[model samples]
Target: MISQNTIDTVFETARVEEVIGDFVNLKRAGSNFKGLSPFSDERSPSFMVSPVKGIWKDFSTGKGGNSVKFLMEHSQFTYPEAIRYLARKYNIEIEETEQTDAEKAITDVRESMYLVSEFAKKYFHNVLLNTDEGQAIGYSYFKERGFTNETIKKFELGYSPETWDALTKEALGQGYKLEFLQSTGLTIPKEDRPFDRFKGRVMFPIQSMSGRVLGFGGRILTNDKKAAKYLNSPESELYHKSKVLYGIFQAKQSIAKQDNCFLVEGYTDVIQFNQAGIENVVASSGTALTPDQIRLVNRLTKNITVLFDGDAAGLRASIRGIDLILEEGMNVRVCTFPDGDDPDSFARKTPYEDLVKYLEENAKDFIQFKASLLMDEAKNDPIKKADLIRDMVTSISKIPDRIQREIYVQECARIMDISEQVLVSTLAQLIQKDIAEAGKKQKQEQKPFEVHRNQKPKYTGYSGGDPEDPRNGPPEDYPGEPGYPEQQQVEKIDILYHLERKVIEILLLYGDKTEVFEDVFLRNNGEGEIETVTEKKEYKVFQRIYLSLQEDEVELSNTLFRDIFTGLIAFYHQNEKFSLEQYLMRLQPEFAQEVTDILMEDEKVTLHDWEGQNIFSKGKSESISQYVTETIMSMRWFLVDKIIEELKSSIVSNPKEDNMELLMMVMDYSKLINSFSRKLGRVMSRYHT
Candidate 1:
């Protein structure tokens, strides 16, 4: 078990911005930081980090938390694992208590796989450096490719012996479970015996963004006609090739610092570039570019420059991937080496400055690059030229930004010597077709989630036995009845949901602030005249809100809002000042995330400026009192409306001789609702029928 003292030290020392900034490209926004969401594919900057509060919130996914929580959510690490990761990043010395069975079990199957992979990486590195076979074969091959000892060691490059079962024996003898080895794809299991999966191959360890070993990519030395040249670790709990980018662990900081990423095709390309003094580079590891991988880099930077070798055929084959980057709403440029070199060989031959200069000078925007490379092929053939123009239009259509699309269309028209109008028209058609197809796909996907009641509601006679009573018969279209639309019910629930959440948001943001409140009462001591007296009193914002809620006996209907409300009330009474980090530490991950969403909702307003709009920035310290009162009155109004609804429902379900009692109660609620609307600065007709 991790000692509580060590956990405390980690929590206090680990800065949320520093820890999260390693993986995300965070820029200063007012007092906080903002960046593109690491969790979603969004072009806008919606992810925010508050350094003072030591918390980060992703508005796109609605996930927010502290340093450890960010690691757990972003990397999918368990609680203890996330704590340990933060501990390592900050160099905090961990103090562990006595070993317990429960603590051992916390390193789950996924972690076991990670542990096994880490062990394999170190063991293979050891073999490559120390063993005779590895030295003469694997070490020699890497050295021949111009990999220095420092580069090899930094990347944890390793080698597996030619002999079968060599790694398996060592791993088993060390008490690492064979099941985990097999699961991580380090050892291929057989009924007869297990053997090393990368035997006689040089190893390349694939790491996640936090520098944890997720998998490996091995390159075989000998050109065995039957065997594949490259073999990657299969999908496992800890390793997902599509979502993991090679060398991201080492390149993330440099990528964020440079605000651009160099995407190559192989592991060697990344290593050689790093060795050549370029650190912001990663490889797709010989797989097709995926949206997940693109998003991985999208978090760190918005620009990706694809590097290709001199092989024209190979470069042409990779041109399609440029569209993938564009589809992710990223700026893509292309760079290619001379006829004799790839990134590895070119960097090896050139000096550092020259290498950097060449890359900068040669990188061309996507439209220019695609046109120049493909124009040669369509050379003077009228049929081929027309097809080439159509292809450019199609590629332009994939870009999500309309302004960018227009710019690229103009670029394409100028380069291809075609009319801009023709290209724009073609692009429009392609986009329309895509929209139509997407609409059809959405309809197909929504069908399963549509209302699925298997039977009709049973109709019963009203208490007065009136057959014509509306409550006794189903309407032409009502919720839960066949053919009834689901949208009305959804809208009704959403109204109350927003109202409840607004209360919780107010309490969280302004509860600790002290404000003056006003009270009015009739002053009469059997004097000549009974006059109204106004009294002013100072109370903490929470006290005023609580008193108002207590007066009505209002309880939040949503489970999350109720928890937040109760917790906030208890916390405010117990402590003088509210500490978001301290309060969040005491809640579960789900509750903590929701509470963070409420607290950080105000931060969203500052990231964007509104010159003439007064819709947001309502919870600033200067305006806390009025904002609190207005929010409370709004909730009271909603609750009064609900009470009226319930009373009306009660009257409809049962017939009364006079109905005077319910009618009077509804009338009182109506008057209260009008009063609330007046105080809230809204007309009565706006909130009341």
Candidate 2:
């Protein structure tokens, strides 16, 4: 119930490009900006944004709308949430209509969860910066690790107090619910008592790409024998560990700009890299890599460098994540620090120049890294060495890109001292085995359903009867019946689709074309009495259609043709001289929906990227205006053609050449139809080539 004025202001102030740019890396293309589709896994750019029109279109998925729609689709934000987000971004004050108590109650649950999460972030941050225990422990720990005050605050590093129930009591006192606290995993419940979950740990807030605090990761400082060093919030409605990446909110821009990402294992690793002047780094928070996490980075960059601790066991365990990255078609490289150092320690010990230089010099492609690491363990043992080669081949087979896979095979063969042919043959066998196993599993899953259908045979394409009439009983005698008339029915559907498209195209291309009808008589004169000798039938029809529209007092200027077309025939009975531009300008949403429905009903039509061809100014006002005009003209011709066909049928049925009234109507309709057809034909002639 935000005031209409507030909504308008938000829309006006929130530039579509600026709003979308925060999440997407957009590059200029003609009059629009083009980028890889965030909604889909696309390698090339198909998502477009038109700043002038204030709309965006994802050509790959066919989703297009204004800025609000983009937020709703991309972030799963509700309409009000999108509006509120815009309001906050643009600093607009919102005036909302008062809601009933029941409505407010329903809203409180979701809003309360968000409020509680924000409150916890603030509380943890304040405790770290202001309190004695937080400073003495958490702050001191971070500082010792070479994290400056700015770095600590930038990452929102904080400390949780040691006392159980401290956060719980404070939150409850502030009118926050225990349920919400537990739901976000900030507090835990046990046998009639609840306690703060992250008590006595240094805090790292895990955030969504938009910077909302979804959850936290906390590291314990104590050396208690039973205590786990690091802990994170449990899975909740807002935070799914498998799908979230730590520090993505802060690192997305740098990742996009660099065209590469540095993946690490923990919060300190990320902070150290950022402090070392490398900003395109994020941590998986020590979990197994998930496709959701991969895609999050994939949206920003296609190249990833996984930084592993130098220890052999850690390196061996982390190699599996590299295969996952390859499977997603991302380019991956591996860099291991010296045996004693992790990313954090290594980055802290070396100067920024040296650290960056070391990464650039030492990072190896996944294939070579896997082979070299495995070869060392299998040294001088032929059987184990053979197994190592097979393992490397299997990993290479998972890569989706054929060229990349081939290159890896050659590299692997060279490194392992095997023939290229031998490696290729081994990869083929492994791939076939994988495919066969997958097929067997699928067949097994389908067996139960197949058994249930054994009693009744499923319909195949044909029956024993004559194919001429599919509905009729099969012909008992003819083994080869004439094929059912599918071709004819398909042709009819094609014609219908084509006709509608052609009509729409013409309207969108040339609806604004003007024509002069002069030296035309409205009435024919007889010897004794006055009679109307209607001019060209098409012209008269156009006049009647035009005049009729005027008589109805309908304003057609700036109206979207799709809407006015439906009402125009009726309006044509009274009015004339309705400008096409007026009809197009005022097109309502329903009309736009109808046009889209019709245009997209058949196979997708690719409107060539005029910008790429340097044909027009991208998303210019003139080009869009011309497109709308053509669409209207095309639709008008379609309607006129229908009218002409009906009138001709009427003449043949009644033999009404002598019936002046009938003749006049036929003449008028024909003239209008011809006039519209000629105008559309010219436009089609010009653009179709």
Per-structure clash totals for the candidates:
0, 56
- Worst lDDT window (10 residues) for model 1? 459-468
Q: Tell me the deviation in Å of residue 51 in model 1.
A: 9.6
Best by TM-score: 1
Candidate 1 lDDT, 106-185, residue by residue in tens: 55677788889889999999999999988999899999989999999999999989989988999999999999999999
- The residue-by-residue lDDT of candidate 2 on 1-689, one tens digit each, is 78777877887788888999988999886666878877666787877777755667777767666667777667656567788999999999998778898977756765687789889988988988999988899889988989999998899888899999878998999999999999889999888899999999999999888778889999999897787899899998788999999999889767865779999999999999999999989999999998899998987778999999889986787788887887788999999888899999999889999998999999998887888899889999999999998889988988866667789999998898889999999888987886688897856764643423213212223322333222232222323313323443344334444544444443433333343322222343445333323232223333433443455344332234434455434433344544433332233434543443332322122234644566653221234323333444554554555566556656766894666676677677666656556655655554444
- Residue 158, candidate 1: Cα error in Å is 0.8
Question: How accurate locally is residue 336 in candidate 2, as Cα lDDT from 0 to 100?
Answer: 89
Could you tell me every candidate's TM-score relative to the true structure?
Answer: 0.65, 0.62
Best by lDDT: 1
Report the lDDT of model 2 for residue 217. Answer: 91
TM-score of 2: 0.62
Q: How close is candidate 1 to the true structure, as a TM-score?
A: 0.65
Worst 10 residues of 2 by lDDT: 451-460
